[model samples]
Target: MVSFIPSKQLTNPQTVLPEQLVEALAHETPLAFQNVEPFRRKSALADGSQKFLLRNQEGKPVAVAHWASPYAPHSVREAIARVNSAKQAVGASLAPHILGPVGHGNVQGSSFGVFQYQYPLSENKFFWPVQRAQITPHLLQFLQEVARVTQVPVPTSEIETKFAAPLQHLSLMEEVPGEIRTAAAQALCRLERGLWAPRYVLMHGDFWKGNVLLTQKQPPEPKFVLIDWAGSKVQGYAIFDLIRMAASFKVKPKRLGENVAAHCQILGCDIRDAKSYLLAAGGHFALNLGCFPLERFVCMMQASVKDLDKALAATEVN
Candidate 1:
């Protein structure tokens, strides 16, 4: 059981419950132990997901924990247990820290705990669909879940928008380096200008290499796990997950077909339609790039433009 201090909404700086999960930590760790500092919100989730720096009584930060809504039939606690258990057989070395059922159960009713590895100071860019199979079983399970959820066709007009844009635009943050910036700018122009119609599919909205953790479970062979499973909605474009994966180098770009094929195999879908999915993935990748300061996304976008050079050059005006 993860230890947690009681939350007092009426306190000085009220510690409100994260919207997703409403359970509290199992024990009372010192409030000072949690290292609550400048944090990078992992993807994003429905309204109230609270991410915190776990600390001991001495105010020493112990771990980073996120309190979110229960995804599976189990509570956050069960989910974390499952993820940890699987680490022995599946995840290998990389263990993503899942924390909490959070506060008291709200409408959905759950108060479990989950855990994962500590968040690194920096993150990488890029990734693809069904790519985490090699690393973490937890990730592969997530891939399967995506297919199962999206199996029911989504109405063209009504995909829910869960990921929120920055409260304030960041055109001011330092721009990405030149080549990366230009490349990304070009791709954005094409996407915005409709150089190609994106073939959309359901997405793990926050798709990229940064979200994937590679564990050196054994010699030569490594296992991969995708974390930050929030805003993971279905009925979005399929490519959103794919293009980012490919560009991130988490998976081979040339093997986008193989990547989607693996998922199709698991879900029993036709692989012939994957290229269109790749196109759609490109669109999602563009949105992810624009999510932060230009630098986070610019290089990956530039890398993608290089891959599409001939095509971009050929799209001449009639």
Candidate 2:
């Protein structure tokens, strides 16, 4: 049976929960460890979900609890689905183990809550790279593994729904620039005819160094665990994830086209169609990741698309 945390009002400075609620969460949740205290809290500004880090009697970090209000049932359901999909795509070891909406009886009356074991402190602090240049080949390989596992064949008939809709929606958004819309329309034209990539893969939606947790126990071949899967998708443009990883790591706009070309190779898509992939990824970002109103995403697209030809052409050099 699954349990849930009761709906409670969060006070000011969203990250800091009320002391009384903290005490209740520590003892009432299913994985309720004894003598536990919350050391940190973060409230997702965009989604209103609350996160708490709890430690046990020995003063070692033990678990994390994530809570959402009953009013945001979609958020709770989506989070649960995304986490399960990630585990299936990347294996249980590479994904956090999510436990119940753990609570006492009256599950229907409670709000949504989930708990997960905390990764090792050292791994959290030092395992993942701090800079784009510091990203290791093994880490890249791990990302590839995630992409590889989630690939699914897309039938020609379903192309419009799966690949073209997002780009179409992006093209129609007034917030997007004219040239970007033109680029999206061109990509949509090809995708509508079933002419671009042949398969769709699950996208992490926000794949970045910060979202990845690395375990260095194996030395030189560290394993990774992904978290915060609230926005993950079972079938989306895979290149979006790759480009997001690069862009989030602060890769320059001009260099992003090159990264897109490389990611095409990784995903078994045609390298010659890298431009189409970039537009599709941009569309996904705008439509799916709530980047339509974000100027940074727009500027990045404008700059990258402006230099894309030169960048990709340069890559063709010996």
Candidate 3:
């Protein structure tokens, strides 16, 4: 049996892995180690998903694993399968190859999912600043590939349903302006009505600089790779990923608008459609903002809301 530690205490990578995880890994993969040290805590999602990196006995970084609590075992299995499917669809150049799940079971009485680690393209911080010119083409190219491989069967009804939490929470916040609340509500309605319909595709779900890495820094042909596939989805709006990517680098509203326009041009879609999707995505973040307690989430929502309003205004005139 793997020894247990308080989840709260599992903060630093210096902490040793639970014997259970170590044994599980050794049993599943050829890789063996005498010691395991934490590398970093990647993310702990609102839904109780946790990611961690660990170094093996040889001091070589070996595995990165995601553990999801309070989830059905089948769901964890499904996520692994989905990650594998996504990796195959995009190829190793875009999505990193997962080493597959080593072991999974109850940890601290909550169900967990563990996966193999894949190296990121760039080890720099997620919010590391880079010139727009450097990343735009690569971002566009990724979107194009996603579009090419995925298909939209029918409009998703969850667009409006997903905003329910935001709307409900905002309604109780007297500090939030009535105008903001009304705008969010209206945006939700528009999505429900199929105004500014978006093409559904296989989405990275949490595309951002933090989840994206640079494999090759050579200009004009730089290679980029995406990580953190736990949130990957089959029928997701591309705009959600695009908006999150812009927010990750803290791009301002004007620049964000310009980028959205450029993206629309490349995809041959209406800018209004992108904006509508942005609005919905903003509300989704707003709902979850209280969960993570990160300032970056606030910044992202602010930019998303600002660009969303601008998009709505432009649509009204046209």
For lDDT, candidate 1 versus 3, the one ahead is: 3
With candidate 1 superimposed using the best TM-score fit, by how many Å does residue 306's alpha carbon deviate from the native?
A: 5.1
lDDT of each: 0.40, 0.57, 0.55
Better of 2 and 3 by lDDT: 2
Q: Tens-digit lDDT track for model 2 on 172-207?
A: 878778987887888788766656765666666666
Q: What's the true lDDT of residue 189 in model 2?
A: 81
Which window of ten consecutive residues has the lowest lDDT sum in model 2? Answer: 98-107
lDDT agreement of model 1 with the native: 0.40
Best by lDDT: 2
Question: Rank by lDDT, descending?
Answer: 2, 3, 1
User: Candidate 3 on 1-318: residue-level lDDT in tens?
Assistant: 222132223546554345565455455444444334344544435445555554555565555555554444344556767777876766665554223456655544444455445544444554234444466557756766675656454335654455444544544444455655665566556645656455556777677655655543454554565656656767655566766676565555565566566556544556655655555555555565655565665455566666555644544522
Q: How do the residues 138-197 of candidate 1 rate in per-residue lDDT, one tens digit apiece?
A: 443455445544444433342222111110111112343454433334433443454423
Clashing pairs in 2: 3-101
Q: How well does candidate 2 score on lDDT at residue 219? A: 35
Of the pair 2 and 3, which is ahead by TM-score? 2
Worst 10 residues of 3 by lDDT: 1-10
* Off by more than 4 A, model 2: 1-45, 91-111, 117-135, 192-194, 215-222, 250-262, 288-314
